[model samples]
Target: MANSPQPPLDALYQEALATFDTLLSQARGEGDPEPTAMTLASVEGARVSARIVLLKGVDARGFRFFTNYRSSKGEQLAAHPQAALCFHWKTLRNGVQVRVEGRVATLEAAESDEYFATRPRASQIGAWASAQSQTLADRAEFEARIDEFERRFECVPVPRPPHWGGFVLAPDRIEFWYGADFRLHERQCYERDADGAWSRRMLYP
Candidate 1:
């Protein structure tokens, strides 16, 4: 099929971002918990893994989320650096979803630190306590570590772990799906060309 008539590149790019933010705001207005939650999928060798991760930020650069760099997903991202994200707002009528596919990059340390500083004190401690994606023998042992960090940073501020930070998925493709009657849904996809221009097209439901 012929390509959809293109809009000015910059406006189209901003339109996609604006639409995402609007959907997100509507979800929150509907009283949904974790409106920023998204399914993050990464790969390891011949295996694929997916898990729910909170969306920490998003912009033209792509979606951002934080995790322990030493975790399994982290290692996989380090090896692959390509991932997909799906944001499904079930609270929306019949549910709407946005899909993003992109290459990932670890954010600068300063950016990570800035976000870490805003987290709750307990979470800050947990960052230093939990060995994310690591095998745990028991709950008590993990609690013990948490207690240990609590006391260690009792008076001092808990700093972000060196192994914990943010990663941004710079999308080359993003699709939005709006559920409709009789399963005849509406799908719009915006793709970024090699020259960094964006073109949007509709996909058959």
Candidate 2:
């Protein structure tokens, strides 16, 4: 059978956005506590690392998440601005997977501050107390830091740490996969061109 026609770049992006919204809603309706969680992969030289991070936001611009600027992933991103993200929704009866390859950039101070303000008070304090990806002498040392920050910020809003902020992954390529019977999955892959136009094609499972 012949393949289906692909939509134009802008239209295809809109379709992808709609699909994402549907999948996210479905995931939540199915009782997934963290629907926005995704696997983020970063690399440094030959070393690669992957971790789960909650998606803070997504828009026409890109996907955004926050982390410690001095952490391992932060340093790696500084050296190599490209990274990959994977979202697997297993809560639904029919699983869905989304993959993105993108270039990362730090958000502006104001943007970071705005997002930080929305975080829970404890999380905001933790961001200041924990030196992410750093060695701690002991559990007590970490707890002491948290206590110190808690006391220091008492009766005041915990300010966003200077090293804690948001990063955006502006995707150049994205692939959506839907599971099927007999291992014959459906794949739609989109790639952005030099002129910043997106083109999509279907791929075999």
Evaluated with TM-score, which candidate comes out highest?
Answer: 1
- Location of the lowest summed lDDT over 10 successive residues in candidate 1: 5-14
How do the residues 1-205 of candidate 2 rate in per-residue lDDT, one tens digit apiece? 9999864547666676677778888999998888999999999999899999999888877889999999999889989999999999888766889898989999999999999999999999999999999999999999999999999999999999999999999988889899988989999998888887878999999
- lDDT scores of the candidates, listed in order: 0.93, 0.90
How accurate locally is residue 196 in candidate 1, as Cα lDDT from 0 to 100? 85
Badly placed stretches (over 4 Å) of model 2 are 1-9
User: In candidate 1, what are the lDDT values of residues 45-158, reduced to their tens digit?
Assistant: 999999999999888678999999999999999999999999999899888999999899999999999999999999999889889989999999999999999998989988
User: Cα-based RMSD of the predictions, in order?
Assistant: 6.1, 6.9
For model 1, which pairs clash?
A: none
Candidate 1 ranges beyond 4 A from true positions? 1-9
Q: Model 2, poorest ten-residue lDDT window? A: 6-15
Total backbone collisions for each predicted model = 0, 0
How far out, in Å, is residue 134 in model 1?
1.0
Clashing pairs in 2: none
